[model samples]
Target: LYAGVGSLSNIGDQGMEAEEGRAAIWRLDLETEQAGIFASGLRNAVGMAWEPSTGTLWTVVNERDGLGDETPPDYLTSVREGGFYGWPYCYWGQTVDDRVPQDPALVARAITPDYALGGHTASLGLCWMPAGTLPGFPDGMVIGQHGSWNRSTLSGYRVIFVPFAGGKPSGPPRDILSGFLSDDEKTAYGRPVGVAIGADGKSLLVADDVGDIIWRVTAA
Candidate 1:
């Protein structure tokens, strides 16, 4: 099984003391009774799924907050074993974050993610659709962005669809459902957390945490 761990105190801002054993994906082998980190430097990889066509493990990560509204974008990408994704020291492959002290060697080693899900979107849900379901969507991913709080203007608060080609994201994101935030933006009618394809195989099931609702969207 693969489990993702989040860092404490926003990428070691309070100091690396709180970062021990954090910001990584751990793998456990039941047969051997062994456990180890599968990957590192991911701040908050909240959602994960396996792409059926490629059998690749993909993850949707919520990047660090407080970095303004658009500095760093949350991402969806194939998780490489033993890969290092930028968390505190850098973002989006070699973009140096001067807020914290960084090791140049580690920054150079950081790998860029495949697709950007917009900065401060708080993206947390991921689901892959197989062929014959959502014909317009083809074989792709549907993500739920639960919205943002730190930004001056809100972001996310909706579901997005990413088309897949050759086992990777191939086009711009399309909206699935939205309008979770109130008009004034002071209240949230709903917050999407998790998403999955329905058992019927042609509809999408969305888990809304705040409103206590599960939305069902079928292909038209």
Candidate 2:
């Protein structure tokens, strides 16, 4: 079993010391009942999914805030065994985070994410989209971007689709559902968080945390 660990602090760079191991992904052995660190340095690795064609483990990460609306981009990437993702010390492949105490060693090992989901989007939910799951859509990952709180203009209040090829993202993201925010962008109609394929094998399920509703999407 794989479990996610979010960072203790959003922007202060606290509680991420080597010994704390607070920001990481952990694996649990069901038989032996032993748990061990699988990957390290993910600020908030929220949604985990396995690629249908290649079987690679992937996740949508929620990066640290307070870098304005677009300093560092949140991302989606494959999880490597014992890999490091560079949380407090660095971000987005060796771009040093000046706010934190520097760790040259871990910074050298930071693996850049595969796709940038834009900064301050608060992307959280991810689910693998299999081939033929939707008639017009290709195999990909369906992501629920829960939207931003600290940004001035706001972003990511809807669900998006990122196409995948050979178990990796290949194209720009497409909007599966949008218009969650009001015309003036001051009010939120809903905030989508969790996403999954329905039991019927064709529909998609979306969980709106703000509206407290489950939305179903079917081919028209």
Candidate 3:
């Protein structure tokens, strides 16, 4: 299960409602209406998947607030239960923004995310390629950073791959699908929101919300 803060609020901002912005990972026991918190403090995790090899759950998180067009960078993270990724308090480990009040006590209590995906990427869908499938893909997670609209220059709107080693994320992301925008790099044709490995074992599926189309990518 993946959990993250669903809203924008600093660690101890009294004005912020927990229910409004907080996200939590929960497992539902269908036998009972019982669910438990697996993790917390995620701004918005729109995509999640479990790796078949290590049984680890990974998520792509949309960080809180635009932060005046350049403050906080949206992220793709490997979520761990009982982990508190600093949402409104701190971002990308230690850069503190004053717009959101920081509680030194709570800030010290938060766990930093696994990877920093740069600012305003609007990361959305996440998927992991199973082993022995695509020759070059290996077994890593691919995330669709949905690009940015709340920025002056704009960012994201492309598909990227995050390689994994030893059953964990090893490094930063590499662009896999680009050129969605025109030559000016201003207008966009498709806004990728989801990514999944095709059932054929050799194709990649991507959903573009703006274009209202689903694209299939195959090994060349």
Candidate 4:
């Protein structure tokens, strides 16, 4: 049940603390409202999912702006509670522009993400397929890279799959869905924002925000 935020408050500075962005994993045994920080420093996370076999939580994070077209890469990562990802200071486990004073010690202490989905990919919507379902999709983490608008050339207008083994993601991403954009890439018919497994058990459901359509992918 961890959640990510661009900002907790609109004040711009007061709500930027990393601890302010987390939420409880679950509500258990209490009538009172109870929540706590799970992880922090995510600019915006539109996608989250748990690996059904191992119960590991992963998230797709949309990084911050103001960096040039390629400075910071949007990422998909395993979200561990109490983890701190650098925001407004560092990125991708590297110290960024010196304008922001990042403690060298703190930067070294932060956990770098698992995969860099290319700069400005604007990753979103993640899900894991159950084992023994999809024959080739064994690891089962599918992510929607929501493409980019800030870059001169747009990128990431497809859905990708990350295979996992023993609860850990391994190997390069596989393009599960693509070709939603025009041949020239100037226009796109779909901008996939979310992904989920279909009720039929063999299909994958994708939410395309740009076309306002939902696409169903099944074995051919």
Candidate 5:
């Protein structure tokens, strides 16, 4: 079984940077019950999936903050074995975060992510949807952007779709569930979190934290 660790507040501010054994994905051997790190340097890898075409492991990462509202974009990428993603020292593949202590050696080895999901989107939920799973949607990843309180805007309060072809993202992201924020932006009607396929195998299930609702998405 593969599981993720977590992220840090303020992007490792106050000497909380990614250290020797933090912010990593661990692969556990169920037979023997042994677990070890599979990848490191991911700030907050919230959602994970398996691409059906290649069976490769992929994830959505919530990156560091304080570089303005849009410095580093949260990303989606394939997880390579023993890969380092540059959490504290740099972001978006070696851009160099001045806030964190410098580390040229490790930054040089950081892996560039495959796709960007915009800054502070807080994209959390991730589920694999095959072609035609939803009436008009194609094969892709379904993500829930669990809204946060720090941003000055509605950066992430809805669900989105990133189309995939072969084994990678093929097109622009499309809105799956939106209208979460109010017209005045004072109240949020819903905040999406976890995502999954319904038991019937034809519909999508989304968890709305703010409204406490599990939305069932399907063809009308």
Candidate 6:
């Protein structure tokens, strides 16, 4: 099994000393009673799912904030074993972050993610959808972006569908649920946190944290 571990502070604000063994995914070997870091440098690897076609593990990551609104974008990507994604030193593959001291060695090796989920979307939940389960969805993935609190204009707060072709993101994301933010963008009606395929195989289940509700979407 795989489990995610997030960093203690943003961009090692408390110092690199505080970031030891953090921002990584760990694999547990129950038969052998062993556990170790499977991947590293992911700030918040919240949601994880395995693709049915290729069995590749994918995750939606929440990138760092406080670097203005659009400096770095959150992303969804297939996880690479023993891969290092930039955290404090760089973002989006070699885009240096001035806030943290430069690390040329680590920055050079940071692996770029497959797809961007927009900056500061606070993307969290992820689940794979097989073809024919939902009309027009095809074989792809569904993600719940909980939205951002720091930006002037809110992002996310809805569910999005990303179509996949050949086991990779093939096109732009399609909005499944929206309007969580108020008309004036002052308050939130609901925040989407997680998504899953319902038992009926035709409905998509959503977890809304702010409204304290669970929503089900089905083709009419």
Cα lDDT tens digits for candidate 5, 1-220: 9898876555566565335556778899999998899998898888999998899999999887777677798888899999999887788898888877787999999999999988888988898998888888889999999875666665888899999997999999999889998877899999999999999989999999889999999988
Query: Is candidate 4 or 5 superior in TM-score?
Result: 5
Per-residue accuracy of model 6 over 1-220 as CA lDDT, tens digit each: 8999998988999988899889988899999989999988899999999988888999989999888787689999899999889987888888888989888999999999999999999999999988887777788999999999899888888999999999899999999999898888889999999899999999999999999999999987
Measured on C-alpha atoms, candidate 4 has an lDDT of: 0.73
Candidates in descending TM-score order = 6, 2, 1, 5, 3, 4
Candidate 6 C-alpha error for residue 48, in Å: 0.5
Tens digits of per-residue lDDT for model 2, 80-161:
9999999888899899988887889989999999999998898889998787888789999999999988887889999999
- TM-score per candidate, chains pooled: 0.95, 0.96, 0.86, 0.85, 0.95, 0.97
lDDT of 4 at 34: 69
* Model 3 lDDT tens row, 1-220: 2334355343435655645535655565677767676766676777888877677777877776646665676666666777777666677765665667567865676776777777778888888876555566666888887788777777888998888888778776777788787767678998898898898888789999988999887766
lDDT of 6: 0.91
Off by over 4 Å in 2: 15-19
Which of the two, 1 or 3, has more lDDT?
1
RMSD of 3: 2.7
Model 6 C-alpha RMSD vs. true structure (Å) is 1.0
After best superposition, candidate 6 residue 146: deviation in angstroms?
Answer: 0.6
Q: How many pairs in model 6 have backbone atoms within 3 A of each other, for residues 3 or more apart or on separate chains, i.e. clashes?
A: 0
Q: What are the per-residue Cα lDDT tens digits for candidate 4 across 21-90?
A: 4322222234555666666655566688987776778888777666777768888888777777766557
User: Which ranges of candidate 4 are over 4 A from the true structure?
Assistant: 8-32, 103-105
Q: What are the lDDT figures for the candidates, one per model? A: 0.88, 0.89, 0.73, 0.73, 0.86, 0.91
TM-score computed on alpha carbons, candidate 2: 0.96
Supply every candidate's count of residue pairs whose N, Cα or C atoms clash at under 3 angstroms: 0, 0, 14, 1, 0, 0
